[model samples]
Structure formats: C-alpha cells, structure tokens
Target: MDPKETYSPLNCPKPVAEGIWIFDGLMIRMDLGPFKIPFPTRMTVVRLGDGTLWIHSPIAPDEDLFSAVDALGSVRHVIAPNSIHYWYMADWLERYPGARSYAVPDLATTAKRPFRIDHPLMDGARFAWESEIDWILVPGTKVSEAVFHVPSARTVILVDLIENFEAAKLSSPLMRFMLKLVGGLDPNGMAPLDLRMTFRPKRKQVRERLQRVVDWQPEKVIMAHGRIYDRDGAQELRRAFRWAI
Candidate 1:
C-alpha cells in the first residue's frame, strides 16, 4: 500500500467549465448513503496566461486522476484549502514530484506529509497576477477557513464552508431530499441547518464577512456541492443564513 495513498476507489468524474476542469471524488464518505460517491470530491484546474497552471482541492487517489492531470499540462501548484480537504494531497504530491503544494493556515500541522505550503491565506487576502483571486478566511463558525473568489473568472470557490451538491449527479431520491433539507440548494450550502444559529452570538462577525463577499460582486459561485450560483449571489448567501446575516 502506498503510504501516501489515502483514497480508496481513486479518480472521479471530469467536468470542465471555462478554463477550469473540476475533478470530483477523492475520499470515501460511508455516511453519505448508497450515493457511491467513491468519495465526495471536486478539483479545479486554472490555466493562467503565463502558461503556469494551478489546481485546487486535489481529491481522492486513483491511477486515472493523475493521468487526467498529466493531460492538462504541467501542474505548478496544488492548493489544499483547509484541513478537511487535505486527504489526497500526499498522493498528489507524490505524483507531481516537481509541483509545489500549499496548505491554508491551519491545515499544515495535521497534514502529516512533507511539503512547503508556499502561501498562507488569511481572511480578506487578495492575490492578483493578470487575474485576481481573493481568499477570505471565514473563521469562528468552523475551525476551517476557505480561499474565496477568483475575480478574473468571476468565480468563488468554497471548500467545506459552502457546498453545492448539484454537481454530484445524485440519482437517488433520498440523496436529493437530504441535500434539500440541509439547504444544499442554496448558494453557500452551509452544513447543519442550524449553522447560522450555532454561531448566533457571532452573527455580527459573520455578517461582516458576508459583506466583504458582497463587495466582490462575483458573477459565478461554486460550492463543494449543489448548483453553481450564476446571478444574485450575495442575496442568495444572505438568505441561506438568514438569521446570521
């Protein structure tokens, strides 16, 4: 067994949009039911103008996953947005020997693998090259923090903090209903129906983060699960945690 191989089935479906291709499934979530997600996974590939490439949220391990990445040209960096999203990084690092992997602030200590997390993202951190991608650390609710927004593409990528399962291709009725019950249909698709209420005391802080997101005026919003939000993303997010925002 490859010590770095944390994934079971390996590989996931391939979905491409704009200049990014999403690779889904990299872990096994037995709790998700007969969903056969192989692993609930999603990955993003961005090709910048200078010919450098960036892939975010590497999911599960599979022979095919690496081959798929190899097909996309040389990958320069792999970003593990949060601790929960680091499961497959070891395998990805092993596969792309020369590629650099970066971990969000709180994830590196527990990652258990050796790699330099070249970038550390704090709340409201903005990175700009020819295009601009902002990382807003939404703290307090969960121990996790997400790197949000890619201005050049008008896209927002949230890890566990916000999920949109619409990309999961759920054929099971139970899965769909479960998703709806948890507000998965919403733009942010926050976990626990009561997440807003869980952090009721910090509602003010949450609202401040939301306000910053609203200021960005993103055109496209993508979560780990559910459908992508194309229009009125700010309002959708506000409505998701109505109590908090």
Candidate 2:
C-alpha cells in the first residue's frame, strides 16, 4: 500500500491570528530505545503581508493541506526551526521548488536526511518579512532551535524548546511512565528534563535570550507539540523556561 494513500488531514490549518494559521499534523511514532509511541506534531503557516506563505516545521503534505495553503498564497519560504524539525522539509521543497529553504544553523550536519538548504538561519537575520517577523536562536541545547516572534500578531512560535503533552494522548503505559518521569505529562508540561540538562553550562546565556522573548510581550504562544497559549503567553513562557533561566 502506498503511504500517501493513507495520508489524511488530522487538523486543517485554521487561523490563530491575523496572518498565522496552525494545524495538528499526523502523529509521529518514535522508538526511544526502550519505548515506542506515536506523538502528535503540528505545522504553522504564516501569510506574510506580501501574500506569500512562510511554512514552519513542514508536515505531511496532502491535497487538503495544499488546498488550504493555496487559498492563502504561494508557498515562498520553508523554515526548519530546529535541527530535529527537518523531517518533512524535503517534501515541502519538492512541492514548492521555487521556495527558499532556510534551516537553523548547523542543521546540515545534524539532519537525518538530505535536503536543500538555501541559507542558514541566524539570530537577527533579515528576510523579506524581517519588518514583521523577528527570530532569535535559543542557546545551550544539543539541537539548535530558533524561536520566532511575529510582531503583527504579538505571537511567538516555538519548536521543541517547550513541549506540553496531555496524559490522554499517551497510548502506552511505558510512554506515560517516561513522560511522567521527564515532566512531559499534561497540566504542567514544560521543556523535557533531559533537554533542560543540556543548558547547564549555558544557562545564563539561555536565560538572557528568554528574557528577550519576555520583552516581546507576546499574547499567543504556539508550540509544535501540545496546546497553544492563547493568553498570557509571556507569563507561560517565563514559567516554561524557569528552570533554565
């Protein structure tokens, strides 16, 4: 059976802000040596002022997803916000051949598969949407993740930096146990414990960067995994990073 035939839209992209739409992508299962379970993922679509779409963390592309995106504008930029988020980048590139692909710095070396990277995303790098979107590199982690802030919407887009997994979403007992041990279960999910440990030596630097995020005064916070904070985003962000900060 063809895998594409099995592809079905999980959550169609819906507007969260004026120019931003988010959708829950298909669940991805991971084998963490001793455990295996399907985990939900998401994709964010931002329609720039110029009517071009900026895709963040590309997910499985299907007719429904493409139709929704096409109704907005041409897909012009594909962004891999972190090294681990490059899974579906090649597919997006194939769909939007003209779109410029940007990956977080050092992704070429860390990515599990090959994809065309037009340029490396750097802190404060300027783009066509620079006036509206600002990006910063979250420091002190094994994976380089870039956090983006859209001034127009007063929103922040995060990848793996902060994950909020609900208990009900865990299908396996082992998965629940592991998530509980790492503090990834519902109600208080923040960054994973192991990922936070990576910030030990660079905690200070990471805090400074997070402080800048706080300074943005974001109203909405979107994470690749888990529920989005539609209100008090800044406060939630501070709480999420309290350990590292």
What TM-score goes with each of the models?
A: 0.73, 0.91
On residues 178-245, what C-alpha lDDT tens digit does candidate 2 reach at each position? 87788656556687877777767787788888889888999999988777788888888888878866
Residue 184 CA displacement from its true place in model 2, Å: 2.4
- Could you tell me how far off, in angstroms, the CA of residue 87 lies in candidate 1 after the best superposition? 0.6
Lowest lDDT 10-residue stretch of candidate 2: 1-10
Query: Which candidate number would show the highest TM-score if scored against the true structure?
Result: 2
What value does the lDDT take at residue 216 in candidate 1? 74
List candidate 1 segments past 4 Å from native: 1-17, 30-39, 112-116, 123-131, 166-181, 185-188, 194-202, 230-232, 241-243
When summed lDDT is taken over every stretch of 10 residues in candidate 1, the lowest stretch is: 1-10
List per-prediction Cα lDDT, in the order shown.
0.61, 0.81
Tell me the tens digit of each residue's lDDT in model 1 across 47-140.
6666666778876656777777777778887888766667677778878878876667776565666556666666444443325456666655
Candidate 1, 106: how far from true, in Å?
Answer: 1.7
The TM-score between candidate 1 and the true structure equals: 0.73
